[model samples]
Target: MKYNFDEINNRLGTYCTQWDYIEDRFGEKDLLPFSISDTDFKIPKPISKTIQKVSQSELYGYTRWNHEDFKGSIAQFYKRRHDCEMNLDWIVYSPSVMYSVSLLIRLLSKPKDKVVTLNPMYDSFFTVIQDNDRQLESHYLQAQNGTYEINFSLLEKQLKDATIFLLCSPHNPTGRIWTYEEMEKIISICKKYGVKIISDEIHMDIKLKENKHIPLLSFLDIYDELYTASSCSKTFNVPGLIGSYAILPNSQVKDEFLHMTRKVDFLNSPSIFGMYATMVGYTECDDYIDQMNDYIRKNMEYVQQFLFENLPDFHFSMPDGTYLGWIDARNVPFTSEQIQDAFVHVGKVAIMKGETYGKAGEKYLRLNCGCPKAKLEDGLQRMKKAMDWLYNNQKGGGPKE
Candidate 1:
């Protein structure tokens, strides 16, 4: 079936974090929500159909992980898409990626032990560290010539004696797909320091043109102390279902994680339809995923061109993966809060403030481009108007304070 991504669907009053809560978050009801990472596109047909099929069943009893229905689907997905072989025993179901990260921190480190991550990443990584009572260490990615690069030297220094390294592939906000060489270096450093690596590959399937996602576990030969967390929720737009998995190869690390969860009785049964949707998504939604990627790439190209031609004062990097566009808005002559306020109040476009990610993100804002083309165009036009208005109103031919 052909999907029409051009149709604009109303998410307002739907309890959507991006839509329904925009006013509460940005303090403006008129704001267009481009803040959250989720896409505005409708769920894939295959997944929706599977959910409908499953709902026809009368029984919704105590759920057990169906070996063939659950694990088999994931193994097939990795084998087909990532070219990585995953054994059934290696997969451990968890509610979400953040939950898995918290569990790993509690299991692998004592209180106040340092947990390292790249800055300008997903905010949840920092939250996990603080919630688990672990010390947080961050290494900011240095941007050069419109691309972000990891500072290996600083990373190595931070990795010393750190108990865990939380990695974000196709990193949030910046949208970089870490090169294999970079991954190898990270793996080597963690190995030298005897630190365990917990990699979040939730956005693995959202690769842009010419970019490939390399799972951290694929480097198991170099380091066996790695745990990979992934989910179809990001790809399939079903995070509310709360189904995710941690892929662990080392039995020792696996046992540690299980013990931590067991102490808290963390085994919550997944949504009844979540199982069906995940199975169908992995088994039969290749074409849907490809089409979604194509749509997102088109939007990315449009945004890049629009910024270059009209909003030249802003700098942005073409994302290597994911539908997010990280823009450097320092030239716009406003503080991060001021820019965020303008976007919300004047531009009526809700975007993530850079400062929320980390101090390194102060001059940046992350824009979600996973929407209909018309919505994206509308957002850019609004932003252009807002900037023009700000520039015109500035005193002494410069931006106002």
Candidate 2:
């Protein structure tokens, strides 16, 4: 079926965190926003149909997520897409991927134990670790030729006594998918240090061009203490449905994890909508995913071209995966604070600052190219307008602060 990715849907007044609630993050309103991770695209019809069907029934009730329809569908997806064999029993549902990570941080490590992950990671990784009283350790990734490489020497140092090696596959902010050999090296290091692996593969399905996402599960033979937290929400743009799962390999730990979900977290049952959404997403939405990715890659190319042609000071390289464009504006001759302020106050636009991810991201900004082409163009125009004004300011002949 042909998907209408060009169709623009008005998200204003929807109480969405990406559009309606930017005041809390950007400290302003009525701006064209590319801040939040979720996209503006509509959910796939198959998933939405099930959502509507459940809504019309007026029979919303506790739904079990351990059924074959849920786990079997997920297992089938991995086997079909990535050639990864997953045992249905290893799947355990959670409210969301980050929630699963939070639960696992507590499950695997004690308070103040170090958890090492890449620098400039998803902002929540910083919070989830600190919030759980786990010491957060940073290992900076080396970016070369528009792609990022993990610094194994420093990573191994940080992993010495670290309890958890929290990894972001098809990483956020910068969309480089780790290759199989790199994954093997990471697994080897973790094995040497006895660091429990918790990989967040939430963006696993957003493969751009020919890049393939190798699941952390692929390293099972090399390391058995691996736990991967992922969800169909990112793939199907249904994060609001609030459901995710963790692939736990160890039987004892998996049982304990399920027990915690049922007994302590009190998520004994999952959201009916979330359960159906996952099942349909994994089964019926493969074609939709392919088309959406094509649209996203086109948008990414457009962003790169726009920045090169119009905003020459800013640089963007087509990422290996994900719908976000990481714009490097280090040569723009302005601090991220100045640029961000100009974007909101002068240009009336909101894009996430690089610093929000980590200190290393201070000269960069993340743009969400996940919306319709028209919306993305408008956003880029607003951003360019802001940058133009900043450039003019240095000449002492533009809009003042």
Per-residue alpha-carbon lDDT of candidate 2 for residues 91-171, written as tens digits (9 for 90 to 100): 998988998899999999999999998977999999999999999988887767777788888888888889999999989
Per-residue lDDT over 1-401 for candidate 1, one digit per residue giving the tens place of the 0 to 100 score: 67778889998878889998887768777688898888888888988877776677777886766477798898889989988887788887777788887887787789989999988889888789988889999888898888788888889899987999999997987888888788889899999989899999989999885768888878887888889888888788888766887888988877777666555666756666677667888999888788888888899899989999999989876789988999998887766765665566668888888888998888888889989999999999988876776667654333333
The best candidate by TM-score is 2
For candidate 1, which ten residues in a row score worst on lDDT? 392-401
**Which segments of candidate 1 are over 4 A away from where they belong?**
259-263, 396-401
List, in order, the clash count of every candidate structure: 0, 0
Model 2 / residue 270 / CA error / Å: 0.7
TM-score of 2: 0.97
Would you list the C-alpha lDDT of every candidate in the order shown? 0.83, 0.88
Indicate the worst ten consecutive residues by lDDT in candidate 2. 392-401
